[model samples]
Target: MKGRTIVLDHIDDREAAALMVDGKLEDFLIVGDAPAPGTIYRARADRPVKGQGGMFLTTPDGPAFLRQVKGLSPGALMLVQVSGYAEPGKALPVTDRVLFKSRFAIVTPDAPGLNISRSIRDEDERDRLLEIAHECMDGSSYGLILRSSCAGEDAGEIAEDINAMLAHADQVINDPETEPELLLEGDGPHVLAWRDWTDPAEVVTQAGGFDTHGVLDALDVARGVSEPLPGGGHLYIQPTRALIAVDVNTGADTSLAAGTKANFACAKALARALRVRGLGGQITVDLAPMPKKDRRGFESALRAALKADPIETTMAGWTPLGHFELQRKRARIPLSEVLK
Candidate 1:
């Protein structure tokens, strides 16, 4: 079997700025702008329709809503804008509330658009909500992402991060009172996570580099100033893409040695490599089968050897062409980069 080359394209610019976890080929992006990223929007009511209203209260007309969100696309994300409700015929508040509806939702393709049945009496407030919806659809809302990075994140932390962004955005909009000079800007943690996911090797930065302390701090890794290498760039351990294909080989002399010994040797080495490198995904090993007398015993021994390794592996019986297939756990990075 031959080694496979992976390819990734169509990356949005926001993804490019993120720190990579995999060095080989994984690509990802934050849903919005830098600095204050990842905002969550919610409306005052889940169902705003009332009987005898005469207005089409379920959802907006297709053509009209599309025109309203012209900047947004069919399958883009939508974080419904949220606000505090007032008594009937009362004025709406200047600020809003955010209720988590399972983080963010992947905007689906629909004709009339997903029915955000929430309604408001004030036209300005409704217009602002529409503005947020359009921004989400256009991929220009706050820089939010649903990621593996947030796997164990608690609700409080996610809310804090989100609230910080909304407050900052509000500050910018109300600069008249605060007398803003430099606008506050930054991306969400997802940008850094996406970058980490793509980079296969450790992220290396030179001594005296900008934000060195902050970067390492966010990652919760120790900081050490090392001798600078010839070229300057960030170092990372993970690859960009999740897919990997490895070709297993047996050297010529090894095959000339006792055939069973050679098969066992190859499997042992491959197993060790998979363990140390954290190799993952489907693995296919092409082999020179052991002599008929030694085949079954060799397989049993090989399977036993892989048992205690870190990654999970399952050996599919050999094919007529003598190639063996194994599906290993998905690795964040490839073995070559890990070993390097």
Candidate 2:
């Protein structure tokens, strides 16, 4: 798994920026000339709004809310991780549980434990990684999660990364600064995409400007237009306030074989579209009619395609009307909202 190229550019839209991976648009970020997600700040808890169930925290960036304030008190100083940018008239979402992500591991400062990605389903491999995690993280008051990229990695390399992250976490924690300010800045989406998705060795190239031809082309594709698939079929994706709806049109066809192939192609395209666009919540895909015998196979293909997505997703079986239902975890604001 070689790392893909990462292209960063400022989009013409003042409200948005673009992160392209492997020459394709991967994310639309609402930078708004402010710090992006993953930034770390040392904040002081302000007065708690009793009815809101959360306390306002004053940070260098601005005021933010700690949704779950179990052990926090007013004026308490603590490290907070910025989860996302602040919405209009809303405070930024901050968390005390911080995670430092590397290519093959995640370091948790607040939670001290060892875990593995559920995607690594092999019993023997899981046990082996657990042993490695314990060995590398022993005596450290931090948590380590072995990412899927650690599947075939050398144990020594994994240990090295764990040690480095642990050391970095220690540096941040040991600092005695009492001011509410930024302690660390998170990597932008382009860097994060490479760390999470691409191989470590992949070369990343950035475009000089947002108006470059490559970026414009990628943005055009990401604008959520109908995508043509192989064999003269297409996928029509529509995202509304409620949920996303996809229509799989096989076009005017004479043979069942062509239609089935088109369905398969459409399924792949739909999965990619949903992931790239970061469209979450409920989703329904209307597929072309097929025989009862072929339905199982088509469903299996669709499920398999979606499994590759980084976010948590589940297929909710078919509706009575024959549309396939899916639910994905909403990690952030949707592309539609960000673009606006």
Candidate 3:
């Protein structure tokens, strides 16, 4: 039950809802209109476009890009999963690998395997979960991914959930009557926030009288503005066309210990901000100058902070100018466009 609260509020005169976690605006989700991520659509592959390396597919949500169309040919029909929302002037990214996710696990029909969350750092727990996954899979040909939320759940409950999801996926995939339509809508911003939280009951939904302050605050941060960090420092977050750039600054009068603490604080805050704002792609963090000997400690602290992120992030080490370089997968539309 120890987790952030999710707030879903209907926007006035807009076709979307404002999603916030612990009173911080996360992103906007289309209400009953746009196709959500994870929606399964039976699509017909269109002619392949040169240089894109992927085939265009006619889906229920219109034309979508099949990022990896390995044995697919033009006019062939197959099931495709919506990977992300359709942004303006761009088609939705669909994948052959369809995954059904619940609170604790994911059921992937095309890919049959067992994978544990990287956030599950405990070796013993990981081994136990792997064993449980094997037992739950029980010779089934469905991929089961144990999420971080499965940490403290009962083995029986997890097994039941996975079994049920696999059964549902199998029924949908094998049913001949299922046409080229949306099987299920993907999670909206509010649901995404709920999934990341340790407890779903913490979420609060408001049908009216939505607060706009959090939205404004999130917009400011998304526009690359500086915000105060802990221990008397500030962090400047700027999103450029290429990548996100963050600068950590300590005031001239602050002591070295305070500055170092602020830098660490900035790292943790930056991670949360990225998730909250839905900022993805490459990111660089420029910390206040530290002693050469202290780089290792800083990197370790930053890495630990970034590990909490649900999105796939890779630490690419420090740049030549002593800035930290990291890459994150673009799971959704950027916050800037969502607000617009």
The C-alpha RMSD in Å for every predicted model, in order, reads: 19.6, 5.2, 4.7
Residue 212, model 3: lDDT of: 34
Over 54-85, each residue of candidate 2 has an lDDT whose tens digit, in order, gives 89999997888888577678889988888755
Q: Per-residue lDDT for 335 in model 3?
A: 54
Best by lDDT: 2
Tens-place lDDT per residue, model 3, 73-131, is: 88888888887655466787888888888778899877778999998899999999999
Best by TM-score: 3
Candidate 1, 1-340: lDDT as tens digits: 1222112211222222223222212222222221122132221222212342211111110110111222333333233221212122322221122222223222222122422323234555444444444544453343333322233345455444445444554454434432112233223334434323422334333432213323223222211111111122111122224333333333344435444555566555555444333345565554554566666776787788777453567777676776666766532233232122
Error of 1 at 209 (Å): 22
User: What are the TM-scores, per candidate, against the unseen true structure?
Assistant: 0.29, 0.69, 0.75
213 Cα displacement, candidate 2 (Å): 9.9
Question: Cα RMSD (Å) between model 1 and the true structure?
Answer: 19.6
User: Candidate 2 versus the native: TM-score?
Assistant: 0.69
